[model samples]
Target chain A: MDNVASLMHGFSVALTTHHILLMMAGVLLGILVGVLPGLGAPNGVSLLLPLTFSMDPVSAIILLTSLYWGALFGGSTTSILFNIPGEPSSVATTFDGHPMAKQGRATEALSFAFLSAGFGAMAGVILITLLSGWVAKFALKFSSPEYFAVYFMTFASFIGLGGASPLKAIVSMGVGFALASIGMDSVSGNVRLTFEFDALLGGVSFLIAVIGLFGIGELIITMEEGLKFEGVQAKVRISDVLRTAAKLPRYWVALLRSSLIGIWMGITPGGPTAASFMSYAMAKRTSRNPAKFGKGEPEGVIAPETADHAAGSSAMLPMLALGIPGSATAAVMMGGLMIWGLNPGPTLFTDRPDFVWGLIASMYLGNVVAVIVVLATVPLFASILRIPFAIIGPIIVAICFIGAFTVASKSFDIWLALAFGVVGYLFKKLDYPIAPLVLAMVIGDKAEDAFRQSMIFSQGSLSIFWSNALVSTLMAIGVVLLLLPLVGMIAQRLRGRTAQSTV
Target chain B: MITRFWAESATAVATMAFGLIIVYGALEFGIGWDSSGPQPGAFPFYTGLLVALASLGTLALTIGRRIAGNAGLQESFLDAERFKRVASFFLPLLAFVVLSVTLGMYVATILYLVFAMRFQGGYGWLPSLATAFGAAAFFYLALEKFFQIGLLKGPLEPLLGL
Candidate 1:
């Protein structure tokens, strides 16, 4: 098909020395940020977006996208060695991974997680390459209602996950919506919060806010907690990865299921966190040995690592096909796309088939390259955690400060970074989930724009949200999903009542 | 004091208070100028209204849970030291804001970085000063020179004469 020829063209662009270098830089930085506790991939991508201004669109995307892949691989290392998850997706990995480390089987766990992540990521990329065109064509049929439904589903997933207190999650999300409103309303053209400042006229920079909230916030919280890594290092032999393959078939089902879930969630914009959580929950509930699930089960590690990678990889589909980002990191990638002066959507694919196909082909190559590099270097990175947190803490904070300033080249971002670092620390202290905050910050405005535009189309009627068959169907699903926590509560209450009646 | 009920309760009140203040702020600015062109107040006014509604709901939830004697809010959200640390960061941050408005981004950054690293983070003169200067220098060169983004013309901009 034409797809194969286009992929060949993509490889030609991706193989260029500059593109390869950019990919390498992105992957290296991504891994480093993922290994750190506070600064996740989204923050890391945002912090460095300013650098993309000078680069071609392909280079910008290669760098950021590689980082997304790198962070997925990187989060596993800390979870395996230190029992600390580098990002939310790695939380499941920690359950079994840390236990395996304590049992002197750290190498086995680490290798298992890495190989699965790499393999799953490769699978996701291949699927995206094959199916992105179809997905984009379908997306092109979407109107305002469908777009708003997509946003609603994505937002509701974050709030309805039952991770944080519902109120806190909603409040944090509301806070994001509020921050998003600070800018000039694209739909309404109102300047709500700028207060006459020209800088405010441009609206709050999502990039800047992300850096402050994730990057700087992490540093401040780390300083408060007192940076320290207390863990025993296992013998990280190079052969562990090779040895782990023998065990791969045992986790084959988890690998496949999580990868499927991840791919579905990612392309649908259900998000990496939801994908990881769903895969882990399903894996645990369905596992033969449910008792082994949470307390360091290998399946736990397999499921989430697989899902995170798949989600990270497939997230590219939306950017390539529809010009919409499925997640925050993808949004940042979209920014890079804009910087490259290469528009993303359906028309671009037709016009610049080389750019489109080359990217897809390059992703396949990049996946292979990333897996090999990560596996070979996992031991070296596991050793970095051995660095004292006191020192690491200061260095991270310094990097964050630099990252923030670089975002706008404005001192305002630096202050905002510190402010967010403090806010992050506060959020952590309160046990409020911070991911929703970050997610909300990234998508809040887009969701608002969709909502307001839909409103205007209906001339300010709420019925439009449910007027369309697809939108109504999606909204019904959303309502059911929102009731999940309440259903759990009811089930628990019924169980108690049954026991009381038995008495 | 660390009870979930109180925390939720207090947060509810704070939320309601903040929402009211925000709504009042919007009203003060003249809400929703729905001109043929986009108005400055429309988005904010709606947002302010939403905040007000959400907070009131939060308050109702808080009260309902408390009256029902549900103690499920046992998880302590904030640590004592967190507030103190927030104060430490916030002061320097506030200073950076004030300075940036007056002296522009580059100059304000130098002062914020030094103060934050040295005093706020409790680093010493050499390391903190060096860290701040190094960061600012790169930012100035990378953005101002490479990207062609002009910096605020403080004492330095006039001498360089563009």
Candidate 2:
């Protein structure tokens, strides 16, 4: 009860006039960004980092995190109304969503998606509020060994749960960690990797890496496919969606199931796409009418849409709670947190209780705003699908270049941005999962420091990892996560061999 | 798809070599004098090791799977026609980066818009030129005049220094 009241105090700060205005602006801007190709919630948040430097920590976090939530919501609009998935998380929506639009069920599909997404996101926020206290207590008990072990498991699991082969994910992460070590060393204060290049002195900037891997990479891939929009031409109205004319209560099972799928993926760092695909698969298998899936089935659309939104929104959990980002956008938000001079962790819930909880409260507020704004304006953004990609192409490029230059107000950063654009193109061509690289770079340094500091604190004792009960438990879980895939493969092979022998 | 996977896998293998060189290079300056905190090489060395090990494992596993009769990597998410359109405009975008630093953002943008619209977009010259100038003007006003951002003005700006 006391805790709830204290959280209410946090709400007072979050609901201030200035804070409210910033949240509004963030939500609006995030939607615009989400609608645009090549710009996700993360990129928009990063591009806006400079603007937050002068603001108080609470408002800064509010602005960035709200922008993040809003962008995730914004992404689904394009995915459902048109065939375009504005963010990666919304990809599954195109499977059934666009088809539903073509069949003139856009109103129902759109409304279901929005309502369930809001419900899912609201659920995620509550989970954060209730679970954060317990999670933080567990996190606070971690020493350096436990911290290193946690980082290890998270990075390793990128291979485990990231839709790629375990080996490829691991390689990508390892390379990222190496790249992270390129500048001056943090602990010993020595020049480790620069090779005497002055530009390398600052090490790789998170801005540079993200712009290259995602923004630029997408730009290249965008070129390969060229610009085309086969968006649905539907006459969807607000009332049609708001009416709840369709009795989808039976599908509530799908919606809830998908939401759980999303929240699990988000928390485990599997990301939105994972949630989308998993929920889509689960919804199909569980459906009484499986054949209807992928053929404009509203179930297909609703399942992935609800799950993606849930995953995208719930991924915020890890980012705020443990300072470990569950998705690229969340990773970018982490940078925004650093820029605002507020580090996220257990301390975030304590010292900056208002900042953390306020951000949570703002999630509720921003989600309502996003639902209203998006539902009202879906037709307008969907109309953008009609614009020729040729026209939209130049506009996106202009935004990318301009946003890149703003990072340093220097010509050099502009050049770096262009260079990254090429690298981005290459990564896309090669089929490399860009997220692991980006995510690893974001946390590589911290993870390394955590490992070394633990060692130093333990006088080079490797056994400290097992000395603490919490650390031991987490490490055991991490080891299981790492080995589970291999074990599964072995079990499958054995089953196959035994069946053949019996035959 | 299997072949393409190997091709990319090879590239990553090469990248690992580059990464190894970087790790070694960073440690050359004695990897920091051992201090109360941590030796400088300590972190970099471990990161480098992880990269080498991970990349090596990735290449090996990918190859191993191929040899084990894994026929092909499964379906790709890319849409071909959509990809083609983005590429044409994308090439010129790289060119725009070079032009911006040399010629200036405004003039470079004008050129980029013209190229993008005419070639990639298949738009008429009049609309293309109109778009080029209009875009430049809007950006100039939004970033420079309204935001008061002092962009590295073009040759034209020097003449019309307001």
Candidate 3:
């Protein structure tokens, strides 16, 4: 009842004329960003971040979150029409989405993707509304040791659960932490890793890193592939959209199951991309006629789309409640939260309920707006994709550089971005996971602070982590997660040895 | 052509070197724990060490795979044609960064777009110049005028003073 009242108040705070207009503009710009290759939700959000510097925190968040929803929707548009996924999360959509388009059911495919995505996002928001208070209250009891334990658990989970080689994951995460510690050490007040360069005083901005990695790095790969867009022409009829919407309820089982999977993944850091793939796999495995999955099955389209948006939205809970982002995009948004003079943790809920709840309330409005706007503008975005890559490509490059420069008006950052861009391209090509790096950079300093603070509390004794039951449980979980992969590998080897002996 | 084996090995070596560099840099500050707490360098030192070790592991794994006659390692990471395409795109991008520093971002934006459109895209001078100027103007209005954020300006902006 208290939570419901708070949400009603949140609705009041978010339901402003200015906010509604900003949401529309954000969605429109986000669709443009999502429709174009090389510009993803993280890139778009970071690029637009500078523009929002002057705005209030509430409006800034509204605009950015709306853009996020819009980008997710726009990603599916390209998947269905061009057979190219605009976002990593949308890749699974192409398996059946493009086939549906080829079969002249483009309208049905588009409508199903958007409507199911909307449903998933709503489910995620409702979960947030219901669970946010309990999470925040639970987190309020946390101390430095608990904080360190949480950060430990997050990184450990990534290494254990992520598909990348554990060694590569560790390397990626270590690089991010090292890079983050380069500038000033707030606790000790010592400049650590400047290497005597003046620019190293403030350290490397994660924003610059993101621009280089996702924006320029992705563009280079796209160029290497020599991509061409031979898109299926989409002609969405209002009647068809209505007809598709009517048929969505028939897949209630898939929708409900996917939403659960998405919410679980979102909260646990598997993220939207992982969630979508897992959901698609589950949908296929459970289907009576699995062969139809890649042959224009509606369930194929519905499952991934639902899970993607569900994970995208639900991921915000951990970011807001515990300051641990569930995905790369959430990591960027959490960075924005720090910049906006707001800390993203349990205190943020009590300190700025209006901001937290308003953002939550806006998610409801934004997804509804995203679906309507995307449904009506599919053809327009498809036509935009028809533009020559040579033109669109250069423009994206320009946007990236411009966005980087605007970060601090430093020419040095332009150079740094280019360097990271090369690193990004090479990392992508080499199968090195970049998310751990981004996540590490975002929370590196905080985690370090938590560890040092806990050490101080225990007079430099590492046992402080296991001092309390809460912290002990958290640390135990982290240790298990960290060792799980190694254990599995050893088990596999033992099994292989047994099989060889039998042979 | 570059094989996957070489590419993997080179990347592993590079990351290893990067980790060692961080480790060295971290030594400047004492990597110790005092009565106050862990030293500033302690965090980075361990992270750097972790990176170095993991990178070594990757390097060893790559070599072990090659030694075991992994056929996939023989495949090309970047063939000649793909290299050509990547270079063509990367060189112009490198030029744009250079121009952004010396010539300023707005002017660089215009010139880069025009060159890409007219030369690379094979579009007409009319459309190229039109797009070049149009995009520059739009960015000027959006970033500078609307957002009130000043972008990098070179000597040209001073001479074209209002």
Candidate 4:
């Protein structure tokens, strides 16, 4: 009942004309960013972040989150039409989406993708509404040890379940932590890692890193591939859209199962990309005609799209409630929260219910707006891909450098962005996961603060982590998650030895 | 041509050097914990150490794989054709950055767009010029006029000012 009342109040706060207009504009810009290659959800959000510096927190968040919803939908547009995924999460959509387009069922495939994605996003929002209150209240009892434990669990899960090599993951994460620890240390007021350079006073900005890595880095790869958008021209008819929407309820089972998978992954650290891939795999395994999966199957289009949007929306919960982002885009948003003079944690709910609940209510409204807007504007966005990459590519590069310059208006950041661009390209090519690095940079200082605070409480005794049951349980889970991969590898090797002996 | 083994090994070495640099910088501050708690350098010291050690592990793994005659590691990381494409794109981007600092961003934006669209893309001169000028104007109006943010400016803007 309390949650419902709070939601109603949130609706009132978010229902103004100003907020709705922002949602529409955000979704439109988001779709543009999504339609273009090399500009993803994270890069798009960061690009718009500087523009939002002057707005109120609620309006800012509403715009950013709406753009995210729009970007997810836009990513699917490219997948179905051009056989290229605009966003990493939409790669699975290409399997059946392009096939459907090739079969002249582009309208049906697109309608199914959009409708099911809306459904998944709604399910995720509902879950957030129901659980946010409990999570916030539970987190209010947390101390430094518990906070550190939460961060530990996040990083540990990323390593154990990230599917990246453990050594590379550690190096990536360590570099992030080291970069974050530059400049003045708040606890002791000592400048660490400056190397006597005056520009090191502010440390490396994560925004610069993001632009260089995801923006310029991605552009370089696209150039190397010599990408051309020879796409199927989608002629969407209202009747076809209506027919597809009508048939959507027939796949209620897949929708429900995928929503569960998406929500689970979103709350954990599997993120939207992982969630989409996993949901696609699950749908294939459970289908009666699994062989029809990559062959213009509607279920194939529906599964990954639903899971992608669901995970994208639900991942906001941990970022809002616990100050831990579940994805790179969410990490950028959390960085935005800090810049807005708002600390993301349990206190945010009590201190500013209007901001928290208003943002949540806006999520419900944003997805509805996204689905409708995307449905009406599919051809418009698809045509954007028809524009030559030569023109679009340089423009994107300019936007990236301009964005880097706007972050505190530093020329040094432009150089820094270029450096990170090279690093980003190398890292991507080498299969070193970039999410852990971004996540580490975002929370690195906070994790250090929590650890140092806990150490003070325990007088540097490491046993403080296990002093309380809550903290101990959190630490125990972290340890298990950290060791799970190693255990699996060892077990596999042992099984291989046994099989060899039997042979 | 570069093989995957060399690329992996070089990257490992670079990361290891980065980690060691951090470690050296961290040593300037006391890495030891005191009664007051952790020193300023303690956190970075450990993180740097972790990075260095993990990078060494990666290096070792790469060497072991190479020793085992891994076919995948022997594949070309970048062939000549791919290198040419990447270089053409990267060199202009490098020029754009240098111009952005010395010249203004707006000027660099126009020049870079023109070069890419006209010379590289083989578009007509009219369209390339239109796009180049249009992008600069749009950015100027949107960023400078609307957003009230000043971008990097050079000698040209001052002479043309009212």
The CA lDDT of each predicted structure is 0.71, 0.74, 0.93, 0.93
lDDT agreement of model 2 with the native? 0.74
lDDT of 2 at B80: 61
Best by lDDT: 3
**Model 1, position A346: C-alpha lDDT score:** 73
- Please write out the lDDT profile of model 3 over residues A1-503, one tens digit for every residue: 87889999988988999999999999998888888999999989989887887889999999999999999999999999999999999999999999999999999999999999999999999999999889999999999999999999999989998888899999999999999998889898998889889988989988999999999999999999999999999988999999999999999999999999999999998899999999999999999999899999999999999999999999999999999999999999999999989999999999999999899999999998899999989999999999989999999999999999998889999999999899999999988889999999999999999999988889988889989899999999999999999999999999999999999
Q: Enumerate clash totals for all models, in the order shown.
A: 10, 19, 0, 0
lDDT of 4 by residue, A1-503 (tens): 89999999999989999999999999998999888998999989988898889999999999999999999999999999999999999999999999999999999999999999999999999999999988999999999999999999999998888888988988999999998998988888887799999888888888888898898999999999999998998977889989999999999999999999999999998899999999999999999999999999999999999999889999999998898998999999999999899999999999999999999999999999999999999999998899989889999999999999987788888999999999998899998989899889889999999999999999998999999999999999999999988999999999999999999
| Residue A325 in candidate 4, Cα distance off native in Å | 0.5
The weakest ten consecutive residues by lDDT in model 3 chain A span A46-55
Evaluated on CA atoms against the true complex, candidate 3 attains a DockQ of 0.90
Worst 10 residues of 4 chain A by lDDT: A183-192
Q: Per-residue lDDT of A1-503 in model 1, one digit per residue for the tens?
A: 65676677788888988778777777777888898876788888886677777766666667777887788778888888888888877887888888988888888888888888887788788888788877777777767677778666665665576466666666666666666667566654555666566666655666776777776666666655555676658665777767777879977888899999999888766677778888989998998889987676888888888898898888888767866666768876675666567766776787777777767776776766677667767767777888555335544555566566666666566566666666665565565556555555555665666666776678767798799787898777777766776787799999999999999
TM-score of model 1 (first chain only): 0.89
Better of 2 and 3 by lDDT: 3
Task: Give chain A TM for each model in order.
Answer: 0.89, 0.94, 0.99, 0.99
**TM of each candidate vs. truth:** 0.84, 0.92, 0.99, 0.99
Superposed Cα deviation of residue A330, candidate 2 (Å): 1.1
Candidate whose DockQ is highest: 3
True contacts kept of 2: 0.69
TM-score, B chain alone, candidates in order: 0.65, 0.78, 0.97, 0.96
Task: Give the alpha carbon lDDT tens digit for every residue of A391-431 in model 2.
Answer: 77677677667766666666666667776666666656765
